[model samples]
Target: MKSLLFVMIAGLASAAMLVSCGGDGSKASASGPFGEIPSLVSDFETFSDAKRAELQGGGEDNMKKILGEMKAAEEKFKESMNAAFEKVKGKEVVTEIDPELPLKVVTPMKIEDISVSRHLVKLVGELELTATAIGFDSYEPTDAFELDDLVVLSYDNNGKPFAYDGLSKDMGGEPMPAGSKVPVDTHIHIESYNAASMGCLSKILITLKGSELYDQAKAAADALKGK
Candidate 1:
C-alpha cells in the first residue's frame, strides 16, 4: 500500500508539472518566428490599460511617467518586430501588383519603382501638384507635405488585404514647385504580422494627397479578401 501511494503521488506531480508548462492559454508560446508578437501585443495592451488608469487618476507627474513608459514600450515593440523580420530577410518573395486592378491616381504622380522586403516597401516616384490642388497660384518649393499623407493598401497573395496610413520615412528629395514634378523616395514600414507573410504585397494601392479617392480605394482593397 505504501508503494502504491508513492506511485500515485508521483503521477499526480507529473500531471501538475505538465499543466503548469502548458499554462492557461492566456499567453502565447514562443515557438514560431513571429510567435513573440502575441505576447508583445498583450504587454502593450497592459501598458495601455495602466496608462489610461493613471491618466484617469489625474496627476502631472503620473502622466509624464506614463508617457515615458509608453514610449519605451513602443520602441521595444518596434525592435522586436524588426528582429522577427530580419529572420526572413533575404527570402525570395514575390512583390507583384495585381494587373487586373491597376493603380488609379487622380492626382498627378508616377510610381517608377517598388521594392519589397519582409519589413519594408519602398516606392520611388515623382509627384506634381497643380495650383488648384494646392489651393494656391504659386508657392516656393519646400517639404510642404509628408509621405504619411498618402493612402496605401497592401494585399497578400491569398487576397488578404491590409491598410496603412502612410508611416513613411527617409523620403529623400528637394521639394519642387506646384507644377514641377518632384522626385520622391518613400519607405513604408510593414507593421502587421499578416502583412509580413510570404507572397504578401501581391497587390498595392497608392493614392496621393488631394486625390479624394480614399473611400473608393478602401472599398476596392477590402473586396480583395477571399479572392
Candidate 2:
C-alpha cells in the first residue's frame, strides 16, 4: 500500500488538474484549458468529507464502498481522457497501468514555463509539498520543508517514456536535531515526456529529482499533468 500511495495520489492530481484545465483556458471558469479533472479533485474533497462523516457515524462498510467508488471514478476519468484525445488527434492509444505507483497531488500551485516545439511541448515548475518523517506521518520539527530539488519533463508525439539521470542522484539535507523529523518541501521538479498515439495523449516519460527534497519534482508533475 505504501508503494502504491503515489499511484493513488497521482490519480487525484491528474483528475483534479485535468478537470481544472477544461477547454476555456480561463482560470475564472470551473474548468481551465487542461480539461475537467480539477472538478474531480473538488468532488474528491467532498467525498473525503463524506467518508469522514460515515466513519463518525460508524459506517465502516460505507467507507469501503466509497473507496471502491473512488477507484471506479479514476478508471472512468482515464476512459474519458482517452476518448477526448481521440477527438483531438484522431487515433486510439494503448495504455499501461502501473498498479504499484499511484500518483498523489503534492500541493496545488500555479505552473508556468509552458513551451512548444514542432512536435513537442515543454514546461518547468516547482512542487510545493508538505514534508513528513521518513517512515512516519508526523511533521518533522526544525526542518519542516524543502525548497531545492528541480525537475524537468518532456513529451514527444511518439509514445515512449524517457528517464534522465541528474547530476546528483541523492539530495543531502541539513543536520537534523534530535527527535526532529525529515524536512519536506514543495519545491520539487517534475519532468515529463508525453506523446500522441492513435490520437490519444499519454505520458510516456517522467523524471524527477531523486530525493523528496529537490525543487524539481513538483515542476515535472505539473508539466505531465498540464500537458
Candidate 3:
C-alpha cells in the first residue's frame, strides 16, 4: 500500500513537470493556436546549404555564373526602386486631398500623425530608407530633411503590415500629385503598390475617407496604437 501511494505521487509530480516544461513558453514546442512559419534565418540557411551542395557537385564556372546573375538581378531591382523613389521627392500631400500615393517604406522607419476625414485621410510621417544608387542627387540631404515621399501602413503585433489586396491593386498607376486636392470616396484604400511582389514591406498608405470603410481605417490605426 505504501509503495503504491508513493508511485502515484511520483507519477503526478512527473506529469505536472512535463506539462510545465512543454508549455507555450518553449519556442520549440509551443504551437500557437496556429503554428508559426520558420524564421528568416532558417530560410536563408536552407538556401545556402542547397547552394553549397550544388557548388560541391558542379564545376566552378557554373557557380560563378549563378552568382553573377544574382548580382545583376539585385542591381536591376535596386535601379527600379530608385526610379520610383525619385518621382516623389520634395512632395507634400494632405491626407484630406485626393488620391495621393503613399511613400515607400523600407526597414527601420517609424510612422505617425494620421488623421481621417469623410473624403480624406491625412498622414504625416517619416521613413528610414537607404539610398539604392550612389549618384542620385536627392541622396545628399541632411538627416532632418532625409524623409522623402512619406507612406503609411498598418502593422500588426507580429510586425506584419496588413492591407487589402484589392485596395493596393487599385492604386496600380502613378498617384495624383502631392498636395493636389481631389475629391475621394470612402473605402480607405492603398494608393501605391508593387503588384508582382508580396508587398507587405512595400510603400503604401491607408486612406480614412469613404463611408463603409471608415471603421476599417480606424481599426487599422488602433492596431498600430493610434488614439
Candidate 4:
C-alpha cells in the first residue's frame, strides 16, 4: 500500500488537471474571433470539497472507492487522449504507468529554465516540502528529506501522458528545522524525439516523496477515517 501511494496521488492529479482545449481552434459563441471557446477543465475546488466530505464520512471503503474512481478516470483519460492524438497525428502513442516507489510523497514544485528546441525541452526547478516527524515514538529530531530522484509526468493539450524518470545528482537538501518549508533543487530533460510526436507544452508535473513520512501520513489519514 505504501508503494502504491503515488499511483493513487498521480491518478488524482491527472484526473484533476484534464481540461478540454477545443476540438479545433474555433470560437464556441459568435461574439469573438472564434466565438467563446468552451472550458473543459473540471471545477477542482468543487471536486476537492466533495472529496473532503467523503473523508469526513469516514470509512476505508470510501477511501478505496475514491481510488477506484481515480484509476478508472486514468484509463479513460488515456484512451481519450490517444484517440485525440490519432485524429491529429497518424501514429499510435503508448503511455506508461509509473510504478509506485518505496516512498510516496509529492510537494509543491515549480519549474524554471523551460526552454524548447525542435526535439527537446529542459528545465531547472525545486520542490518545496517540509521534513516531518510523526508518531511520538517514531519521531526523529534531526531527520532530513533526501531527494534521491524526481518523477516527471505531464499531458499535452490533447491529454497524452508523457512520463520521464529524471535522474539527478545535483538535487537534495540539508536537514532543516522540523516542519520548515525548504526548496530542494532539481532538473529535467525531456525530448519529443521527433517533431510529429511533439505538440505544444500544456502542462508539467513533478512528484517527490519520502519513505518514513509517506507511511506516517497514510496512517494518519486512516486514523481520521476511524480505520
List TM-scores for all candidates, in order: 0.35, 0.26, 0.24, 0.30
- Give the candidates in order of lDDT, highest first: 1, 4, 2, 3
Clashing residue pairs, candidate 4? 27-34, 27-35, 29-35, 29-36, 105-208, 105-209
Model 3 accuracy (lDDT, Cα): 0.32
Name the candidate, 3 or 4, with the larger lDDT value.
4
What is candidate 4's lDDT per residue for 1-227, written digit by digit as tens?
97699899998876543322222222111121111111111222234446667777768998888867755654654454344323333211222222332222233233332221211223333322344422112234445434444445543445543333343333234443443433333333322121111233344444443433334433433442346
lDDT tens per residue, model 1, 6-105: 9999999977544332323234333322234434544556666777787887788988987898788777867875564455433222233222222222
Model 4 spans with C-alpha error above 4 angstroms: 1-120, 133-146, 165-174, 178-197, 208-227
Best by TM-score: 1
C-alpha RMSD by candidate, in order: 14.5, 19.7, 18.7, 20.2
TM-score of 2: 0.26
Error of 2 at 122 (Å): 8.2
> Model 2, stretches more than 4 Å misplaced?
1-31, 59-61, 81-227
Model 3 lDDT per residue over 122-221, tens place: 2233322122211112544432211222223433223334433112111212223333222221222322121111112233344323423434634544
Count of clashing residue pairs in every prediction: 0, 63, 5, 6
